[model samples]
Target: MQQIAIAQAAEGMVLAKDVETGDNRILCGKGTALSAAIIERFRRMDISHITVEGHPVVEEGAKSLKEELLDVENRFSKVRHIKPLLYLKKRIQERLIASRRPQPAAKSEGS
Candidate 1:
């Protein structure tokens, strides 16, 4: 599963997680297959992103995984020796990789 910006969401994609509004109203349940109408509704609600059960939608000009990992390492270099911070850095790195990994595309109507 991957979180993608609403602008990148396409029809027929299944949501991996529930989508909720700012005040905690559930807009859509998890596992819902998105459609053009649903997507438009989300846009109207000002939703920015949603977790989908498929490959991440890499934005144009996004950083490569290697570049991202290196940047994260560099950012945490100064506090590497700190035990608590080291753990935090490790968790951050894990999440970074997960977010960047490519998965199979969501099934479309044509499939």
Candidate 2:
């Protein structure tokens, strides 16, 4: 499944997880195919992201994860000497890598 920002979500995509409101009430359930109305509702509610059934976002000729790490390192080179800034850069790089990794599929009852 791919976790995508609300703006990236489109109609007919199956939801991989339940979408809940800030107060913990489920607005939509898992396996629900998104529609224009639902997408609009999510936008209205300002939901940041939701996990969908597949990799909907296409990356054509984009930098690989390693390349991205290197880019981030280079961008922070000037501030590397600053302890707190360096720590923040390291954390950002880690999050980038983690987010790019492919998530394992959820197990079904038959399995």
Candidate 3:
């Protein structure tokens, strides 16, 4: 299954394939809806810089989904912020990679 790298992801974009293990342990799956609720929350918070998930961070010209999300999540909220989202994305990717790793029969069975 091919998926756009997080750097290439954007808001309102649907994942193309299921991010899962050969044994079908899903880390992040295809057809997962972008968190539109978060967008609305930001809008309510008076944040105009909206970022979607899985997009590259551009410095200036135009903000990507991640960038916009970061700006709002970081600038407005004292609790939720860009770091958490980044961490979540990273953990998901790591799980996907780990799920793909070849494991011994014992490990596989345990999993």
In the range 4-107, model 2's lDDT, one tens digit per residue, is: 88898877777889999989999888877777788888999999899887565766786777888999999998995799999999899888776665444443
**Which of 2 and 3 is ahead in lDDT?**
2
Please name the candidate that would achieve the greatest TM-score relative to the true structure.
1
Candidate 2 Cα outliers beyond 4 Å, as residue runs: 60-111
Stretches off by above 4 angstroms in model 1 are 1-7, 20-25, 35-55, 102-111
- Each model's Cα RMSD: 4.7, 6.8, 16.6
Ranking by TM-score: 1, 2, 3
Give one digit per residue, the lDDT tens place, for model 1 in 1-111: 678899989877788888999999888887677889889999999999999874557667978778888998999989957999999888988987875554444543234
lDDT (10s digit) by residue, model 3, range 1-111: 223434434444544344444476654444444344533433454433322223324344854445545555465455455787767655655554543333321111112
lDDT preference between candidates 1 and 2, better one: 1
Q: Order the candidates by lDDT, highest first — what do you get?
A: 1, 2, 3
Q: Best candidate per lDDT, number?
A: 1
**Candidate 2: how large is its RMSD?**
6.8
Q: After superposition, how far is residue 103 of candidate 3 from its true place, in Å?
A: 36
- Candidates' lDDT values, in order? 0.80, 0.79, 0.43
Q: Measured by TM-score, how close is model 1 to the native structure?
A: 0.58
TM-score of 3: 0.25
Q: Which sections of candidate 3 miss by over 4 Å? A: 21-24, 36-111
Clashes of each: 0, 0, 5
